[model samples]
Target: MTVHDVTAPDQERDREALMPEAVIDDEMIASMQARAGVNLRIDHSVNNEEATRIAVTKFAGGIGDINPLWTDADRGRASDYGAPVAPPSFVMACFSGIQFGWPGLGSFHCATQARFHQPVYWGDTIAATCTYEGFTGPKPSSFAGRTVTDHFLNTYTNQRGEVVAEINWQVMNFERASARGRSKRDDKKQDLTLPHPWTPEEIERVEMRVLSEKPRGDNPRYWEDVEVGDGLDLLTKGPIGLTDEVAFIAGGGTPIPRLKAHAASLVDYAAHPAWSFRDPVLGSSEPIYAVHYNQAAANAMGVAFQYDVGFQRQCWQVQLLTHWMGDSGWIIDCDAQYRGFVYLSDVVELGGEVLEKVVLDSGEHAVKVKTHARNQRGADVMPGHATIALPTREGASPVTLRARS
Candidate 1:
C-alpha cells in the first residue's frame, strides 16, 4: 500500500511547508498487522480507577446525557442498583485502546462493539488490557485513496478480578493528502459550508424534542411486553456548542500532550512528530486530533470542516439504550457503525426498534434492538444494535458473562 501523495497543487504547496512526514505505507501496515492478536502496552489518556458520582456525571455531561440514573446521586441511591452506575461505555476512561495500528495515517473510528458482564458501581475500580486484533485493507473507499481497517480488543476488569466489560473497536486508516486530492477530483464545487444557521422555528422544534426527552426510569420494561417493531425513546444532541469538543476532552475523552502551551507543546511535537502536526491557522503544533475541532487542521487532514469525534457520537447512541432501559435493566451487548461525518452544529437524533425477543437457556429475558443516529441532513451517520436483559415478571436473574483470563 504505497499511498501516492496527490494533493491539490496550491494546497499541497502550503501544507508541505508545515505538515509532518507521515503516511500509510505498506511497511507500516505490515508491521502493525504482524502484532495482531498480541497483547500490547499502551497508554490511555484517563484511567478512572473508581466510579464516583462526579466521574459519572462528567462523562454523562460530556455526551449531553441528563439522565438522572447517571447524573443524580439521590436518584441513583433510590434506584435498584443502590448507587450511581457509570454508563457502560464509561469504561472508555479506563482504557479506550484506540491508539494502535497505522500510527501516522489519518484515522476514523468506524465501528465499536461492547459486551457488558456486570454493572460498574460507584465504588468499583477498573483495570484494562489491550490487544491488536488485526487489520484488513488497502481497499477501495468512497473517500481517500485506499483504506485499512484495524481491529482492537480491550478487556476491562474490576479490582475483584471480575470481568466487567470487553469492547472491540475498529479504525480505518488512510493517507490524508490522497483524500484531499480525491475530494478535489470528485467535486470541484464542493459546498464548503460553515455552521448551519437554524431558523428560530427550527431551533424551537429541536429544543422542544431535546427538552422533552426522559429516561424510562423506575418503569420496568418487561421483556414479555416488548415486541418486534416497538420503538425506543429518542435521544437528541447538538446544534453542538462551540466548546463541546473541549468539554469532551476535559471529561475524560482522549487527551494529547500537544495541548501543552509554548515550549511544552514544542517538546511534545519534537518528540512525537507522527502524532503531531503544525496548524497553519493557529500557528501552533497540534495533535492529529485537531482535525476533529479545527477547520484548517481538518483541511490538512482531507476533511472539509471540523467533525464530531466518532467515539463521542458512539457514546450518544449508547446513551439512547441506557435511557430506554431502566436502572434494573442491563445492557448485555451494544455495537455501532460510524458511516458518515457529523460536522459541527449537526443535530443527531438517536432511536431504536425492538428486533427480536428471546428467553435464554438460563431463563433470562433478552431483547435485541436495532438503533440508528441520523443527522440534520437525514443521513444515518451511525447505525447500531443492542441486546438488553430485562427483569421478568417471574423474577429472572440478570444477564452475566464469564470472566476472561
Candidate 2:
C-alpha cells in the first residue's frame, strides 16, 4: 500500500502529537525485560567521536561541575588516573536519548537507582540492555481507581562482555482523576531576607571573569543578531571522576547495597526492606565508600572500575542552562535519549545555540533552541531541544495607567 493509502493526515498528526517516532509494543517490553535481567548483547562501536564528546558534555552540564579534569586534557593527565575520565553520571547523558520501546514509559513519574561498576575509556566499544523488573503500587486516586507502576533494570557491558553499570528505575503512572483533584498552588515564594547576598566587589569580579570567558567563536551569537531559525553548535561535557560522583551520590542521598552490607556487620541492622541500604531511598546513617569509591567490588560486578550514577547527566544539563542563563530563564521542557556508557577519566564538552524565535501573544519573545552534549571521543551522548524567553530587541515599554479622583 502507498503512504497516503496507509496513513491518513489526521492519524499521522495525532500520532506525532502523542509520542516519538518509535512504536512500543508488548512483545518489545517483554523482550527488553528479559534481556535486562539476563545477559543480552547490545553493542555500539566507538566510531562517532563527536557523539561521545557531546554525551560527556551533557552529563557534566547536569552536575554543575566545572572541574578541569573533565574539560582539560592536560589537567586530567596530571591526575592519578594518568588520563582524562568521564564523570560517573556520564552514562545517563550518553545513552538515554535513543529510542527504547515500552509504551507509556515516559508518562510515568520516573526515578533511578544506579550502580557504577567500571570506568569506560575513550576507545571502548560498549554494549547495553534493559529488562523489566515488574510493577508496584495502585494507590487510590481521584480520577482513575488505580495507578500503574513500571520498573526497569538496565545493565551495560564493554567489548569483553563485562558489565560496567546497572540501573534500576521506577516509573509511576498516576491516573488522570488523581491529578485533577490536586490543589492548585503557586509554589514560587522566594525568601527575600537574604537576596543578593554577594558583595558588590565579589559580584564585579565574577561578572568580569564570566564576561571574559563567554564562549566566543568565528560564528558569534550576539543578543541583537539572534533571530528565528538559528542553529547553535553542540555542547561538550565530561571525563567524569570518582570525587564528583561520590559528592553527587552522597549529596543526593543515593543508597548502595554493598555499602549497606558493610554497615550491617558493624551495627545492629533493621530487618525491614525499607531500612535496607539496598533500598534506593532509605538506610542512610553514616558515610560509606565501598560502592562508589572502592575498586574491588567494581571489578566483581564485571565493570572496568568504579564509575558514577547515570541520572546525574540530567542534572548536568539542567545546571548548564541555569548557570549560564541565570534564574530568569526556566526549563520549560526537556527530553533525552541514552546512547552509550560513560566511565571515569573521560573528558566531555557541551554547548548549544538558538534554533527559532517567535513573539507570543503576550509579546514575550519566545525562542526555541536545540542543544547537545558530547564526550572527548566526539560521541553525542545526549541531544535535545529547549525553549526560553528573552528581552525583546524592540525595547517595548511597560504600560502605565492613571486614575482620576
Candidate 3:
C-alpha cells in the first residue's frame, strides 16, 4: 500500500523543541554522590547566650512543644538536675550552617533518620561534617518508569571532639516530564492501602488539649487577624536529655540502622569522644566539658542533660512557615546560617513579620515574609525569608494574558 506523509508544521516545530540537556544514567548519579560531603566548623563564641537561646526556642515554637524543662530555669533546676535542661530534640532544632555543594540540584526534598549519641549541653562548641552515603539507580516503577535515591549522613561533635549526634537523610529526584503516565499505578496502590481515619470525638479531644497547651504570648493571632506583615515572636526550646533525643529519633521515620546505634551509645563516654570544658567562655579554643549525657556533669554546668541536634532547627523554621500558612500555602525558598551552639535549658524564640506583597504579572498574588529564630538573650540564630501564595482579596480579577489562544 502506498502512503503519503501529512505532518503539520506546528506539530513538527513542537517535536523539535523538546530537547533535553542530558539523559538519566549511572554516570549522573555517581557524579552527584561523589561530591556530597561538606565540612563545617562551629563558632561558639559570637553571642553564645543569644545563639543558644534562639536555637532552642525556634525548635520548641515550631513543634508546638511547651516542655517546662526547656523554658523554666528554676523549675528545671529543682527537678532531676540542678539546672535548666534542653529538650532532646533541641540538637536537631538548632541550625547548623552547612551548605551542600552540588550542581544542577535545584531544590532539595529531604527525609531524615537521626540518632542521638550524647546530650548536647550549653556552652559547648560543635564541629560537623556530612558525607554522601550512597545512591540508587532508577528502578522500574509506574511513575516515569524509574527513580533515583540520594542518601547523605552527617556527624556532629562537641569542642572535645566527641560525636554527639548522627543523621541520615535521603532525597528522591524525579524526572518531571516522565511523571505524566503514572496516575493509574498510583491510584491502584492507593486502593490497596488501608485507611486509618481519626474519629471526630478523638479529634475534638486532641484539639482541645492543643488549644489549652498553646504557648503564652501577649498578642493572640486569629486566622482572620493575621496580615502579610505580622511578625512571629521567638519560640523557646531545650535543655533536653538523651532520653528526649531518642524519642524524636525513634519517631522520625527512616530505615537506616546507624541512627539507632548512635542513640544507644550516648550512655557511655568510652564508646564516643569525651566531652570537656573550654576557657574564657568564648574563644577559638577546644572544649572541656564532659558528661554530655551524665546527670552530674549537667548539674555542674547549671543545665539539664544533653539536648538535640542543631540542624533540626532548620526543619523547625520550615515547619513554622508551613504551619502558619496552612496546607494550601508552600515554602518556595529558605536558607539559614548557624550562628552559635544551642544547649540544654536554652530558651529559643522564633518571630517574623510580613515584609511585602506583590502581584506578579501572571496574576499570582505572592507574599514576601521575613522570619527569625532567636534565643532568650536576644541573639538571632537563624534569619530567613519565605515566598508564599495566599488567596487574593475577594472579587480580585486575574491577570490578563497577552498571548493568543
Using lDDT, give the best candidate's number.
1
**Model 2 C-alpha lDDT per residue in residues 1-405, reported as the tens digit of each score:** 001136576854333211111223456445555544443222221112222544454445436555444555565455333455554445443343121224322222245555555555444555556565555544554423355556666666767676666666665544332232231111123222111244567556544543343322112123355665554432334335667676554333133222333656346234322211221223333222233444333322223344445455555554454344422232344444444435465444555767777666766555666666675457766665655444333543111000001
Q: For model 1, how does the per-residue alpha-carbon lDDT over 120-183 read when each residue is reduced to its tens digit?
A: 8777888877888888977877787678888888899898888989999888888777787776
Tell me the deviation in Å of residue 40 in model 1: 2.8
* Deviation in Å, model 3, residue 389 alpha carbon: 44
How many clashes (backbone N, Cα, C below 3 Å) per candidate? 0, 74, 55
Task: Give the root-mean-square deviation of each candidate in angstroms.
Answer: 4.8, 22.9, 25.0
lDDT for model 2: 0.43
Q: Give the number of colliding residue pairs in candidate 3.
A: 55
lDDT of 1 at 387: 86
Q: Higher-TM-score candidate among 1 and 2?
A: 1
Among these predictions, the greatest TM-score belongs to 1
Model 1, residue 43: what's the lDDT?
55
Worst 10 contiguous positions by lDDT, candidate 1: 396-405
lDDT of 3 by residue, 1-405 (tens): 111337576753332211111336666766766654533332321112221544555445545555444566675455333444444444443332232323222112234445544544545555555566566666754444455666666676667676766766555544433442243334344422111234667556545644443333112122334566676543434332355444433333111112222335343223322222222223211111222333333323322233334345565665555445532333444445445434444445666888877665655565677878775456776676666554444522111111011
lDDT of 3 at 355: 82
Q: Global lDDT of each model?
A: 0.75, 0.43, 0.44
Give the deviation of candidate 3 from the true structure as CA RMSD: 25.0
Off by over 4 Å in 1: 1-18, 21-24, 185-192, 256-264, 396-405
TM-score, prediction 2: 0.39
Estimate the TM-score of every prediction: 0.89, 0.39, 0.39
TM-score of 1: 0.89
